[model samples]
Target: MKQCLHFLHTALFARAEELLAKRIIDGDPLAYFLQGQLYFEEGWYDEALAQFEKIKEMDFQALYQLGVMYYDGLGTKEDPEKGVEYMKIIINSNSPKARHLKYAAAYNLGRSYFEGCGVKHSDKEAERLWIIAADHGNPKASVKAQSTLGMFYSTSNPKDLKKAFFWHSEACGNGSLESQGILGVMYLYGQGIRQNTKAALECLKEAAERGNIYAQGHLVEYYYKRKFYTKAAAFARRIAENDNIDMLAKITDCLPVYIAKGVAMATFYLARCLQLGVGIQQDQAAAKNYYSRVSVSLQVHSVLLLVLPIDWINKFVSICRR
Candidate 1:
């Protein structure tokens, strides 16, 4: 029975439901809980509430879930006060059964305090509860707590950037995608730790591979600036093919003479790739258009020099020919 219940909670729902049906027919209380969870997942909140209500002696898990339903108005009218009361009861209880329920309850109650849902808005109180919940062995709550702490320390006034770095790094390690991207940027600029270009590239690349768009953009710029034209073109092509015209325009615009020479080289390489179908599809018309624009700009510069002294024009012509 315990193993079946564990399976249900651990998300082997189909198998758990099949096994739980027989136990529920036998009027097992744990089976009621499992059935209630399945019903809740299926959005049959009324049926779930009926099943949960059948457990006359509610354990912490049942009580916590009931509180959640009330607070969210899932199967009943919204009653924040009632939800808060139920959560408080679980927090104050020393019951050995379903002890893990405290982490979820505490996390939810902390959010209520944070948002002034049912309780008065109190950041300190919310932080306290989050700390407790985070320490209670819940991975979700722990990630939330670490992410919140990272943001809290990331302020600029009395900069606790080192602590911010630590929290974000820890959160990233714990699978927080936002933290991974933020930490990558931080490493790039040496916000708290020493700037390590290699480490920053590695971190941003990892995040980009995991579908972080911001990291992808940064990688495009990084490779372009470093004269890694092939890599820059690849990343830029991804953004362009995804229909991000603004970003593609930004990549192309980097070729202006006033910008770094490496940027121009990268842009030219990208245009060539698009033109020749090197790594991406051939777009000869688009390539010709870009090349024409570059030529027009250089011609404009040459025409401007035509107004200069005859000696300067001769020298400029000589330089252009060379």
Candidate 2:
């Protein structure tokens, strides 16, 4: 016990010295980025911005990170204008890294226009920009554009189900978890597609395997609905065990897409596991935390149900009616 305590003390003090040395490290762009990250985490936005700005030659990733900070109010005040300014500079550059940033820039600019954030609202213009981004292979933008196209064609004078399917397919093929999850929903609901439980499960499984947390959360239900109780319980264990924050962010960021439709399924699976203590160590507190998130989602969904369009209601009703 004394040896263990001594080792812990030495480890702690060594870490402190290492941190101090890191703070004094100079002439390193990566170090500046690291410092900027530390400052941002501490809410010292101005100091973080200064560190980021001291880089002698900004790489594409640095430019992208700076844009994100500007947009997210991380190391600077939220400024879509400045964010897009940096984005445009990289977008016009010939660097290979700039290609992805170019698509991201177009997507952000389109969103700004669509939401009238320091710009005018123009659906046509928004679609144009989204198409440009999608064409350039931005997975996020492709998902957005495809989903938008699906919605547009879903309710129009001359509904083009094929067009909707094409866009959704494109987005799904490009590895957009959002698109994969949505395509699963469309298949489950027979929206511009046949209702195939097997196909829907396949889509969800693919997305889930790709670290789409939302899909992982939703897959719990699809497995359950098929009476694959063991599979459902195992899936919950996998998600709870996953340590990757980026994958978690995929689920956390677009949580509504899954929570709105998958909460009941997740709750059911979670309850089954907690009651049986299957695979995971039984923890009521953990189960309650997940339930609480589902509850909040329920409340938001209830509010959204009030404003849902008639056509959307009809479509859902049609699925239920089947």
State the weakest 10-residue window (summed lDDT) of model 1.
254-263
Total backbone collisions for each predicted model = 0, 0
lDDT of 2 by residue, 107-187 (tens): 676776677764678767776777777773445554566555554555445777766766767877765566687677668
Model 1: per-residue Cα lDDT over 137-158, one tens digit each: 3455557666555655665346
Model 2 deviation from native, Cα RMSD in Å: 8.0
Predicted model with the maximum lDDT: 1
TM-score of each candidate?
A: 0.60, 0.59
Best by TM-score: 1
Instruction: Please give the lDDT score at residue 316 for candidate 2.
Output: 40
The regions of model 2 sitting more than 4 angstroms off are 1-47, 55-61, 92-97, 136-161, 208-257, 264-296, 301-322
User: How many Å off is the CA of 129 in candidate 1?
Assistant: 1.8
